[model samples]
Every structure is written in C-alpha cells, then in structure tokens.
Target: MNTDFLVIGASITGINVARELKQRFPDTTVVVIDKESGCARHSSGRNSGLLDAGFSWSPDTLKARFCKQGNQQLSDYCERNGIPLNRCGELVIARDGDELSDLDEIQRRAEGNGVKLEPVTARQAREIEPRARVHEQALFFPSSASVDPAAVMRQMEQDARDAGVRFYYETSFLRKAGDEFVTTLGTVQAGYVVNCAGLYADQIAQQFGFAGNYRLLPLKHNYLESSEVPGAFRTHVTAAADLSGSYPGTQIFLGVDGKARLGPAVKPALWREQYHGAEGFHPFEMSSVVTTGIGQMFQGGGEICRACLQRFTGSTHSRLITAGSRLVEGIRASDYRDWARPEIQPQLVNTETHRMVSDFIVEGDGKSMHLLNTVSPVFTCGLPLASHICDQVAAATGR
Candidate 1:
C-alpha cells in the first residue's frame, strides 16, 4: 500500500491528525491504521469524557494552551454534530484548610490560563450544586463540560472517512523498513508517518528509531460504579486540595449521568494497558502496582495513602456513593450505585524512571510528528493540537 501519510492508531488523536492533514493538503492521501478492529476500542473510548475547562495545567504548558482552545472547539463540534454533551460544570472542592490553599493556587493558575473560575464559599457551593457538601470553599468552573467519549470518536471517524481518509482495522504496524511501515497486512510506503498510537505510541515511535527519548509506563486506573445512587449527583466533583506524597492531586468527578466514579489512582503496571481485576487486568502487573503504589505513598505521604485506601475499600457501589456524598455534600451516596463501573487510563511512563509524564510531549522534526503522552486533556485539545500539528507538517514538507 502507498500513501502520502500513514497515521498509526485510529483514536481521537490519530483521526483528528488525519482530518487536519487532509483539510490542509486536500490532495494528499492519508491512511489510518489500527490494531483494533474499529475506532476508540482503547483509551479514546474509555475515559471520563470530560471536556476540561483549561484549569488542569499551568499556563506555560502545551496542555494548558491547547486544552483551553480544544475545550471550546469540542463544545462547538458537539453542538454542530448533535453529539450528546452536558455543560454540567465542575467543582474543585477544598475539604480542609490545607486544600483551601491549593484551591486558591488552582484558581490563580486557572486565571493565568484564561479560564474563568469562581471561588465560592461552602454555602455558595451548595447553591450551585444543591447537593454539594463542601467543608471548605470550592472553585467552580462553569465552562467545563462532559461528552460521551465513544460518540466523539465515532463522529471524528465519520468525519475523517467523509474527508476521504482511508482506515485499516485489525492491522498492526509491525515495524518500519526504510520509508515504508511494515504492517500485519502489508508494507505501506509513505512520505511521512505520524504516530498517535496512545498506549503503544512510545513502542511504535521506537520501532522507527524516534522514541528513544522516553519509555511508556502504563498505569491502571480503576473506577467503581455507584450502586445506590442512580441519579443524585449533577456536577463533577474533584479534590480541592493537593494530596501529599506521590498523589498528583486527588480529585474525583461525578459524571453527568448521575453515577459517581472514583479513581485513576496511579498504580504502575508492567503491561502497556493493564486494568486491575477488570477485563483487561494483567497478573504480571500486580507486583508493579504494589511497588509503585508504595513508592508513591512514601513520596506523597498520608494523603495518597488515604486516597488509595478509599479507592480499595470504596470499590463497592455503596462505598463509592458514600464517599461521593462526603466529598460533595448534596450527593446521595445511595442514589448513585446503579451506574458505576471500572475505567482504566493509559499513562506514558518514562523508561528510565518508570514514572508517568505529567505534561504533554510532541515530537517531530517537521516531515513527521509523533504525539507522545497526550493522555487526559488531549481530547479537549483536539482542534488546537490538530492545527498545530498541521502547521508543522506543512512547514516541514513546504507544501
């Protein structure tokens, strides 16, 4: 097979990149290949599905800039394409005096990133989310929205196909030979290759001698469905404070569907896409999770330990609902047990340190660019990131 460009991975990043490339160079042929039989069978389909409101990262990071733009773009796309979305807003709840300080810092950072955040008192938190039971103040980001992740990927795939992008499913990229990618199906020749292979991105890039800079460490994020409360919660609830130790910032979000799910705890796993005790769990990953979790606890301290304990014990539907209520006042723990389930997030682990990348990393010298570690908010930044990638590719090819 021959094409002008080959996009490895048909997730949001790959499809978005392909679509953007075609839009810019209408005459160029673009081909997308994925190991899965269809689109979004992996991370793109199984995520919190929240369109972040741009407060997650520092203003200087690529994530912060692209996320701010992507959030707006995604909202607009959902509106145009009739994708289901809930602008239910988000609350970064500060539970104690210590968390209040972090909440303030988050607010300041949000302001710097051009995201609007309102510091509301506990009373005000209840006013906005009548079910909220905030112990300290909360930072409300009204612009944050949620979407059905599968729907978004489906729409993107449809759009890309409509734009004349070709997709090859159940085909894996085995390696690269000279200027062609050796795949399970056949060798594909291409002028440029873009690797947006999500969980396997680093491995794919390494096959082409491009991703020696880092190694991917996969972490299993577990989610619990609310057993009792089916439709009690409204807005997303996140930890208002920065937890001590290796816990980045313990936060949980309530989905728009009213089921409260917790987690994405940073449990390191050996496999690239391990989920604990779930359908995708790998037995070999148990030791890794234990070791990494202990290391994180040592570094982060009691806060992460508490959070981990909560997650382990709270895996039950009833416990999750209770935890959600305690964290977010008006939420009825019993009302959410019906809709909770486990969800795993893929983390880009540094090969040397075996630690996850906290920020986004984009690599390419112009002709070909690989989007490495576009973990969480990448979906929200799809538009801006696509534009940026397109601009770079165009400049490199001088097209």
Candidate 2:
C-alpha cells in the first residue's frame, strides 16, 4: 500500500489526524490502519465519555492548551452530527476544609486556561444536584458534558470515511523496512507516519528512535454503574482532589443518558492490555511493568506505594462508594453492583525520572511522529490535539 500520509491506530487521535490531513492537503492521500476489527475498540471506546472543561492542568501544559478547545470543538461536533449529549456540567466539591484550597487551585487553573468556572455555594450546588455535598463552596464547570463514547466514535469513523480517509481494519504494524513500514497486511510506503497506537505507541515509536526514555505504564480504569434510575444525579459530581492532586478519587460521572457512574479506579496493571483476569496477557510486558512499578515505588519516597495501596488494595466498589458518598448522599454498594467495561490507560512514564507523565508527549523528525501519554481527557481533547499533531506533521514533512 502506498499513501502520502499513513496513520497508525484508528482511535480518536488517529482518525482525526487522517481526516485533518485530508482536509488540509486535499491532494494527498491519507490512510489509517488499526489492528482492531473497528475503530476505538480499546481506550477510546471504553472511556468515561465525560467531556472535560479543561481545569485539571496548569495553563503552561499542552493538556491545558488543548482540553478546553477540544471540549468545545467536540461538543460542537456531537451537536452537528446529531449525537446525544448531556450538558449536565460538573461539580468539584470539597470534602472538608482541608481540601477547600484544592478547589481554589482548580478555579485558578480554570481562569488561566480561559475556561468558565462558577463558584457555587453549597446551597447552589444542591440546587444543581440535590444530592451534592460541599464543605463551603464548590466549583461548577458549565462546559463539562458527557456522551456515549461508542456513539461518538462511530460517528467520527463515519465522518472520516466520508471525508475520503481510507481505513484498513485488523492491520498491524510489523516493522520499519527502510523508509517504509512492513505491516501484517502488506508493505506500506508512506511519505510520513503518525503513531497513535495507545498501549503500544511507545513500543512502535522506539522502532523509529523516538520515545527512547518514555514507556507505557498501563493503568486499569474501571467504573461502577449505578442501578438507580437515570438522572439519579443531575450532573457529574466529585470531590476536590486526591493524593496526586488529580481528580482520580471517588466520583460520579453522569452519562449522556443521565445514568450515574462511579469509579475509574486508576490502578497499576500487570500488562498493557490487562483489562480483565488474564485477558490480553503478555508475560514480557508484565515483567517490565512490575519491575518498573517496584522501582517507582521505592524512588518516590513511597508516594507511589501509598497511592497504590490507597487505590488498589480494596474492594473497588466499597472504596468508590465511600469516596463518592462523601461527594453526594445516598451512595450504596448495592446500587453500584454492575461494573462497566474496564479500560487500560496507556499512560506514559519517564523511565529515568520514575514519574508518570501528566502531559501529552509528541516526538518526531522528518519520517514519523509519535504521540505518547495521551491519557485521560484525551478523548475530550481529540480535535484540538489532532490539529496540533497535524501542525507538527506539516512542520516535519514541510507540507
């Protein structure tokens, strides 16, 4: 196969890159390949589907740069495509006075990132979500929304196909063969390559001499579906912050259908694709992940270990209920019996620093570009991130 631009991994990022490239360079051929039978079978399809309003990171980070815009663009995309969207918004509440400052920090980030965040009194918060609890004040993200991820992805794939972006499903990238790539399907000769392979992106990029110091640290994210009627909660609700200062703690995410979900226990996984018991098991990857995790636990003054213990060593449902109960009333273990589809977060780690990377990493030269650490909120940031990546591709290929 020969194409002007070849995109590996047909998830949100890869699909958007192909579509954007085709849009920008109409004369050039753009193609996307994925090992799955269809697009977004992995992380993209299994996400929480919460369109973030971009207050998580500082303004200096790339995540901040893309998230707010990505949220708006994606919200617009859903509306234009007639996809269902619940504009339920999100509430960041404080469990107590100790965590109140974190809300302030998040509000500061919201302002810095040029996103609107409303400071609501506890009464106002309850007015928004009757079950919501707050110590004094809570931050409301009006732009925050949710959709059926699978629905959005199907629409996006269709959009890409309609735009003349060719997709080769069940096609795997094998190796680089001298200015071209050897894939399971056939030899692919492309002018430029973009890697968005998720779990295996770092491994693929290593072949192209990028992502040398970065490696995939897969975190298994699982959510609990609430049995209560839809609209059990009027909006997504969560506490201020957790140990890592990110919002990975117990919280409830409302789907586009208004169903409440609690979870996303971000625990370290044994392998890259270790979604369930022994599924997608890779002995080599497991060994590497265990060793790396052990090393990180020792180096971070046991911070990683403490975080792991707090998150991983428990009945996941009970932990979620406990944490989520603090944010809103009426959370019980029985109501959250069903576990949603679990996903592996292909998080990137700086091997040398023994730290998890919180921002997106893009590395490229002339031949190829690699996107690493495109983790949570990436689905929300897909459009803008795709645009940024295309800019990198243009610069690298002189397009």
Q: Point to the candidate with the largest lDDT.
A: 2
RMSD for all candidates, in order, please.
Answer: 4.0, 1.6
Candidate number with greatest TM-score: 2
Q: Please, what are the lDDT tens digits per residue for candidate 1 over residues 1-399? A: 999999999988889889988887899999999999999888788787888998858777888888878999999999999988888888877777767777777888788889978888888988777666677688899988888889989999999999999999999989888777799999888899988888777767776667684654455565555553645556777775543222334345656465555544444455656554455566665555556555654343354456556545544555555555566654454444343333444555454444446677777765568778767778888778878877777777787
TM-score, per-candidate, Cα-based: 0.85, 0.96
Backbone clash count, each prediction separately: 30, 0
Cα lDDT of model 2 by residue, 238-317, tens digit? 77775227436777889888999887666778998888898778999999888778767766466556656766864366
lDDT of each: 0.73, 0.86
Q: lDDT at 222 for candidate 1?
A: 55
